[model samples]
Target chain A: MHEASAATAPGRGGRDLAISVRDLVVGFGDTLVVRGLDLDVYRGEVLGFVGGSGTGKSVLTRTILGLERKRSGRIEVFGEDLDKASAADHARIERRMGVMFQQGALFSNLTVKQNIQVPMREHLRLSPRFADELAMLKLALVGLDLDAADKLPAQLSGGMIKRAALARALALDPELVFLDEPTSGLDPIGAADFDELIATLQKTLGLTVFMVTHDLDSIYAICDRVAALAEGKVIAAGPISTLLASDHPWVHAYFHGTRARRFQDVQ
Target chain B: MEIPDGPTFKSSRSRDAITFELAGRWTIGASAALEDGARAVFAEASKVRRAVLDLGAVAALDTAGAWLIDKTRRELAAAGVEARLERVRPEYGILLEEAHYRQFEAPSGKRRLYAAVLLADIGESVVSFGKDVLAGVSFLGEVVASLLGTIIAPLRFRAISLVFHIEQIGFRSVPIIGLINFLVGCIVAQQGIFQLQRFGASTFAVDLIGILVLRELGVLLTSIMIAGRSGSAVTAEIGSMKMREEIDALKVMGLRPVEVLIVPRILALVISLPLLTFIADMAALFGGLLVAWGYGGINPAAFMARLQSAIGENTFLVGIIKAPFMALVIGIIASMEGLAVAGSAESLGRRVTASVVKSIFMVIVLDGFFAVFFAGIRY
Candidate 1:
């Protein structure tokens, strides 16, 4: 795992940082959800965000994607400040990034095949045959068969839905991927398998992953760095080992507390 | 006088004229027993001219019980036997009266005018059909090709998935339509009663209910309801999908959200709204019947008879004609609102509300136009 992490690091690979977020604050109405959060995502690195519920991990991610309005912030993706980017520039940035929602959020009415093909059809000028081939490739990458592609989201199991959503996220061959609770609700084995898949994909595709999750197992297995958030603040941020050994009460409780101890025991 | 207790038989030697002495609350728990009792009564009344239903001991009856009785009566009538209420309890009598038992009568000439309004709905349908055809031709193979490409390329599947999004936006929105139709029926009956009673033409309530329900209220109400319910649902569903990065995913993979998601929902809503309106019309009429029998002292039979006499075949045809046009308005409004949905849940809610209100308002306005246009015509 260490060797795999070293191989994908931006400096080692001679690639530039993929995302740089500085002093980002997001609020809803008059209430702030994300306050003064700063983070950096290097190319091909899996950056995991661990926080209690309502700490604005999702809000921060959405702000980066321009889906949520930022009260104040500087978010640069591929060296472009997305906050001030034009509609066309935003679209260009979006073309290079893919997102997988926590719920899988698969289009309920669409069949799996259609769901996989949606991105390809939207951004590219590909022919029908070419699009089908692209969709099939992505499905295969997620270890899903062509038969699964024809089934609707309602028909797929929870695990399969997540896999399908992953297939969709990878459909654009994005340089950066945002996954909100990618291993959430999955059993330990499924989550482990997902972790392995993410690790393998990150190495093979050289994709930068920004994941928000509370799953300690995922952080240990796939994440190169971890960021802890609490009460609308980044309480700690650094390499997983560094944050785990930190003296901060919240960090210690989150990373070395009873829950973490239990997670460690599972391995 | 205390009626002598007789033996309860599934099939008796005498003509089938037996009643279950329901002493407790009449609820769904007795459904099986009620079915058995109805079957027994039907079998025994084979040679009888009329079957008497005694409900004096029935303490309470709900919609299920009422439906059971209605079903039993219909079955008895099918066998050329009349079913009469004998010693009906006050509550059951009220329930029966509420169901329009006293308002059954043939329709009148005013009902024909209502039918003409329904016929006018067809004009709107033709316009929608043209729009759908145009949309279909414009998008055509591009949608199919985009979906196909997702199967082959590593990152192209996002585009392909968008083609099927239209079904979510359009096809599964019937519940909203049904709900709106039910409410519209209640409001129309309530308002109609108020207007008719002012002129001391209370009996004409039957004629008004029939004509309005069959021709004007049924079609008009249904169209407006669909516009609000399905239209708003469609808009919100698509808009939220857009906000969730799902639309962007498709675009990044080179798929047209308009061709893939918007078109199919538009088509589905356009096709489904008219059919939904037909169902809505029936529901509204049923609602009117309930209101009429409950407050207007009209029996279901006389009410139906007056409805038949007052509402000619043309009124029904006219109502049907309006359905497609109503469908078009709903489809267009919903799709437009959906496309306009910004990337947020709040936007989804706002757009959905706007879509429903706008579509219903437009449908009502269009209904007025049809009324005036038909009023001026010789037909």
Candidate 2:
């Protein structure tokens, strides 16, 4: 597998990379947020991305999703160059990926079931029976109750919103899913349950997940490899053991910080 | 590489045992093929005593694909035919297990009859109208208490906010109000002259314009405009702030929202409306004077002389006196709707629309009441 960091990660050359970024630079006006960042996500592995509050972990994800413009760089998804692809090719590429925003981003007007069916209705043709069954299947996969299917996003609680958004993201059974702060607003128990859910879905679906999160427990629980962003580039990328072993100041502080110390004993 | 390969099942029967082998990409993309393959498998499986479904040649599978295959297997077994999956890869097995089929409860059926539903809706609206009046009265009480408290403690009053809102709702509205009233004044004068000229009384148009502009048209038009413009603005502003929990934040900060937010805005509305009414009256008179001179052969001197006798002090005061009550009604309705905003953006939008419509309706209704009162008093 092609691991993100060149130094610590063992590279198995033949394995497919789900997402590859080379010398990517993204900025807003004068402030560059992702400077010369290089990263790779192997297929069927959950890559946990870490950063400080303003370090622009989301900016990098948005750049790869083509929602935010990159100043310079190459981003390839499923071996197709995002910049060079035709509109139809880009759409085809997009259909293979799903994104869940931090705020749950479900259409407020649409019911939860309708939200899950949006991607399917847009890209595929299926009978109402199959469509309803699939939407129900997605909701079940996310551990949401069947009754939540009819309720609007505003009616849902924090954890339910996350689950509904995840169900919507998995609407097309996408190979790659981008989750931004998937467990942020959830309670401790809720966060653990969510992490377990992600882990289960990742294994069963063989999905390549790119999760941007500050939840250390989620990083430890579900992530196969963790990458840390500092100074607008990935400073370290490897297993938690490698991150703990790093001498880099930010890396040392992040994993060894007061709040992070709780996990050290557990590990 | 794009694999547009669709699903297919090859079936062969030997005596009573059937062997079915599924191949090609069994994914949601090939939705029709998945259904077709399932149908073909189920059709052949029921006739056999024993059935073997092979997935060894299946190129790809997702949750939807696994769902159809798993469901077909279970249904076949349910029909007294023993069917089992063969050569299922570990990932496909997990996916099949995850996407197992079960009955989902459909939405409840049978809505009420159309006629009964319409009657119920009408009943609900009438009751709601009564509740609305009660709510409006309660809101007026709260606002009055806040006003009294502010009056009692002069230091608690927000003078800066009052000034800012006065500028926002009053001064900024002058140009549009002036322009619309001027056009309306000219139209009324022209129409009056055109009709009265048949009786050799073209100059009588000046008296019509004077009475109409000073007593009814000027204040009514300005109030409606303010209801549409500033009333809607107030609702939208307060509704958004309430949505973001800013009102709650103020309450937690030991300040009354009605006193801080609504009082200043309503006070500004009350102070601005009469001034705007005055401006509207002057603009209408100016427009009438010009129209009489140019359109009806009555010079400005003749128009002014005729207007002085045509309208008394009561004509101007009657319109000016109604401005504050109209302003209060508009302000109360707008603030009430604004405070009613719930958690959703759709709720805020609905509240703003209701604020504008209700305030305009009430303004017109209130004006009709004022006309009757003034007529009874012989004003």
Task: Give fnat for candidates 1, 2 and onward, in order.
Answer: 0.00, 0.71
In the range A1-267, model 1's lDDT, one tens digit per residue, is 111123123234344668877777889888999887767777778999988888788888888887888888788888788867899988878977989999897887688878977876676554564456556656766777567867888677878888999989887677799999999989999899899988877765567999999898899889987888887877777677668666878888888887678765544
- Per-prediction DockQ: 0.01, 0.75
Query: Which number leads on TM-score?
Result: 2
Candidate 2 clashing pairs?
Answer: none
User: Mind giving the per-residue lDDT tens digits that candidate 1 earns over B1-379?
Assistant: 1122221332223444544343443433343454455456667665676776666666555433444465567777888887766677665655444332121222133555766777777877788758855653444344445445545663634333433433443345456656666666667766777788899776677677666766787677667655655677778777888778888898998867765676555556556656766777777777777777787766789778878788787777767777767766676667767776875455688889878887787788878887787678732
- Candidate 1's TM-score: 0.44
Question: Model 2: how far is A119 from its true place, Å?
Answer: 1.2
Interface RMSD of each: 27.8, 1.1
- Model 2 lDDT per residue over A3-114, tens place: 4456535564467889988899999999999999988888999999999999989999999999999999999999888999999999988999999999999999999999
The CAPRI-style docking tier of model 1 reads incorrect
- Most accurate candidate by DockQ: 2
The stretch of ten residues in a row with the least summed lDDT in candidate 2 chain A is A1-10
